[model samples]
Target: MADYPRHPDREEARLDMSISQVWAAERISCPHRDILRAYLAGGLEAAAQDYVAFHLEVIRCPFCLANLEDLDAATSAEKEELRQRLGRAADRTVSSSAVFLERLRDSGAGG
Candidate 1:
């Protein structure tokens, strides 16, 4: 077996995705956090192609699709705030589900 040297400084370069492409990727509700994740995770070309299609503003309107870049710039506190918001949303959803289940039980529609 042969061993190869690895360089710790060798980090992958970032691709310049358009705002609209990022927006579409986001609006489409992909599982990953953002297109950058896809790019870094070995789908560089796919991510680039997605943005390239919208670079000319042909696919998505740039005016409405802007701000994707800034979406991930939150500080620790800001992230905490967002986490709290998501928690609240989840709590509300759970409460609603519980209420519905209770109603179903009351109506003898559930076991």
Candidate 2:
């Protein structure tokens, strides 16, 4: 059996009794779920969006399409939840001049 969760809407779904079941996720190989989410969020660059578009629209990757659909169908609460999750994942980088000066001095350059 495939360890990865298959898309219910995929061709194989015809054989799956869970076809009528509504799932929140799908297991796919290409254009990882994150990329799909980023694509829907419009966070991806033009080229990246183009690639995902090709994968979902042209390649017809059911799993990714399903993810995209889910993202598109997200409610206000769901969108807020996702926004919070992304906010928590952000990096806190300090780019103060003191930090740069210290780095410069360590590198034998004038601070």
Candidate 3:
């Protein structure tokens, strides 16, 4: 079972990596999420003076940035709904496949 969250609308919600989400953040230290919020809100310079390496790496990762944009686009309720549906689908697939394999073994048809 895959533990990472998956979103079907990810491609649709993707945003280009702006300079705010990329450079100009390496010299400011802060929590990644906070830095992102601050950057979005025109407060990038207020992050800190120690330089945020990990946060900049996150911003530079295209996949991570796309997921972050998807998150930003979703309302709390919509995000929760998606999470619940994916979890339930994964659980159902796992359980059904296990039962089918067990039945196959009992019937002497297991691969």
Highest lDDT scorer: 2
Cα lDDT, model 1, residue 2: 90
Ordered from best to worst TM-score, the candidate numbers read: 2, 1, 3
Provide the TM-score for each candidate, comma-separated.
0.34, 0.42, 0.33
Count of clashes, each model = 0, 0, 0
Candidate 3 C-alpha lDDT tens digits along 1-111 = 779765556543454234445443443323566555444445556434224334446444444455456546654567789999999999999999999999999999886
Better by lDDT, candidate 2 or 1: 2
Model 3: C-alpha RMSD to truth?
19.3
Q: Which of candidates 2 and 3 reaches a greater lDDT?
A: 2
On the 0 to 100 scale, the lDDT of residue 86 in model 1 is 100
Segments in model 2 whose C-alpha atoms lie over 4 Å from true places: 1-29, 80-111
